[model samples]
Target: MADPPPAPWIGSVAPESVLWPGVRGTQQAAEWHNAPIDFWFLPKYAHLPHPVVPDENIGGMLTQLSATLRQRLDAVPPTPPPRRTRPGERQDNSRLKTYRTRLRPNTQQMEALRKTAGIVRWTYNRAVEYLKAHPNASFHDVREHSVTEDGLPLMNLSWVTPVLYSIREQAFFDAHTALRNGLADVRAGEIPNFELKFRKKRALFSSFRIRTRDWDGGCLKIPNFSLGPGQHQTKIQTGIDVPSLEHDGACIKQENGSWFLLWQKDMGEEKMRVPAARGPEMCAIDPGVRTFATIYDPLRGTAAKFGDGDHKRLFRLDTHLDELISGSTQASAKKKCYRMRRAANRLRARIRHLVDELHWKLRSYLKQSFDTVLLPKFNAHQMSRRGQRRIGRKTVRAMMTWAHGRFRSRLNEAMEVV
Candidate 1:
């Protein structure tokens, strides 16, 4: 069949200026531009057949929408995305594998790590302010303004010492990367352009990168900090044998008051093996607020639903967080602030773990049952923002917590998804 001519300003239009036709509110109609084939209800005026229900039965827009939805539900799934690489190409010996081992740093070593991280936060904030004034300035400009030729510190960093030179240097590099990446995202229309904010110590204090030269056997040497017997060094708690690494490592402090080291090391190549053949079955997944996923198999004439089953616990945690965060205007003790922060962090960690477990289980089920999984483009933001048909605040909260993007990632890992 002869295809219709493409639109004139399709490729050239800026994302913000483009007007989408059928998607009532969101600019997500642009999502269809990347697809090669057409689908149901797109553009709202495609020459598609109507549902079996008579026109007389449809009274309002809601009824018409329900009829259209039924038609869409019965339609065949669209084509799957093209695979990026062959099965075994992802984990070749040439690639580096990252290991996150817990660190058992003593009180002195822990203090030193915290101090270094604080300095990094300070340095990065300074760099952000510098970029605000001189938009074209690079990391070298900040470095020059912050320190002297002989490496003596300048720029309000009275706590800076000669031993912490490496930490300072790495901080500048990180700050530069952050600014560059943020600007790139702005240009790409993924994020709106705005004034950069300082990195707050209260926020998830990002990890500080250190060179991997300190890794010796199962011990990591801490710079600047002194150990009683020798220079500061900490043992990594892991059963696996530590391999020689050639990159930088990051020291991260977890929410539960634990420290860990994220190290990347090259694992040797393995023999390429083809993946097992998948069964000839397909299913459609509809993500909803109440259920984690609603599965429909037209071939088998059956349907199923899955739920996280952690609703009660999650609700309790949410209520606790709300109580802790309320009444921020009044003066509160440091003890109260500490308790609130601890509760919030623990809740965040628990939610993250639960979501991971849920997705993992869904992936296992999809891999076992279906050769192809069909996932609709679900925009929780758009769903919640519907003007007249907007969901309740509680429902919106539950839907947002589903983390649809993470679920898609899990499906991609083990299943053929459309």
Candidate 2:
């Protein structure tokens, strides 16, 4: 049978419009635009009968596309717009294929899903390790050693073997093909030892399977994987507002505790078509040690503060963990250290949660109060300069380890930082 036609392209409103006022007079103004809807080809092997595509293939495709676009821009001249379509040129929806489904997996299914993910991770890492150990070997030769009927270097876990086979049979060849073609241009002598790593957790089973269509008063039926065997199947029907592809939807583990599925209907390619309203006022923010965040709202002409106590609490937790570690006897030290580590982890998680909450609160306030948000483009290395100048060398090193850059970036996005 012939391949399916490309998914329909939908028109979408600009998201940047919501914050346009703050960026109106600045260079950042150029960054805002109507969200463009373009034709994105679904992978040939990603059809329902097929399993999920391999990470390496996806990563290589992205890498190759980036390089190609970069080179194309350098070589091509700017072009003028084409003429508008005549009245008779429009196509009918009758011939189009539109799919909408709600997906949900039970508890046992969630475990199966996790196993599939773990298998993929192991495969990619094993491939990379093989390449490193055998630099002289080509990817094709390495694949021979790395992959089995189920996948290369099989895991100790036995139950998910079928899933592994599905991935290997469906995606392994395509992934290898993409990777080989992508790296073909690299000079043999200049081959980098390191492989490019894609964001793993976000990419796993990113594709969604259609469940029931137009169920639950037009809400897509989504699976609840967290429910156990007795309560395994529950459907969530999110109203017509389709979930964005980039947005992380709720995932519940299935009854078998292996498979996972998206808890909502994916908006898919239609997300870009929605219209965006202009944002509120603009603000300038300074994030630092003395102040978690110092915000200067241009619209209101006022500053706000957040995250003041986080650093102190983090320090206290660290000191306590250190004291616990230092005093524990060697015989019981390992268990004591584990407890301390767990406590420290919990404390750190709490701090992170607080930070996230503060970020959202500040963003919400700014969105309601201002049109734009401005923030210093801070480099953490530069911020650590003071520590290097005044504090001991080791102290400076320690200070540099904190996620100052990450926090600033998160805050900047929240406020639409230019």
Model 1, residue 104: distance off in Å is 5.0
Q: How accurate is candidate 1 locally (lDDT)?
A: 0.57
> What TM-score fits each model?
0.61, 0.44
* Candidate 1 structure quality by residue, lDDT tens digits, 1-418: 4655744543332341223222245434421122132321111111111112323432353355445544554466666564322111232323465667666766767776677677777766766777778877865687775433343345344576523565566666666666777777788898988567787786643576666554555554554455222444445444455544466543445445667777766544342111222332555676776667766554353455565244555566667666766732242786667666666667777777776677776688777777557577777777678674357877777777778877886676453222
RMSD (CA, Å), each prediction: 14.5, 19.7
What's the residue-level lDDT of 416 in candidate 2?
25
* Residue 178 lDDT, candidate 1, scale 0-100: 64
In model 1, residue pairs whose N, Cα or C atoms come closer than 3 Å (at least 3 residues apart or on different chains), thus clashing, are 93-268, 93-269
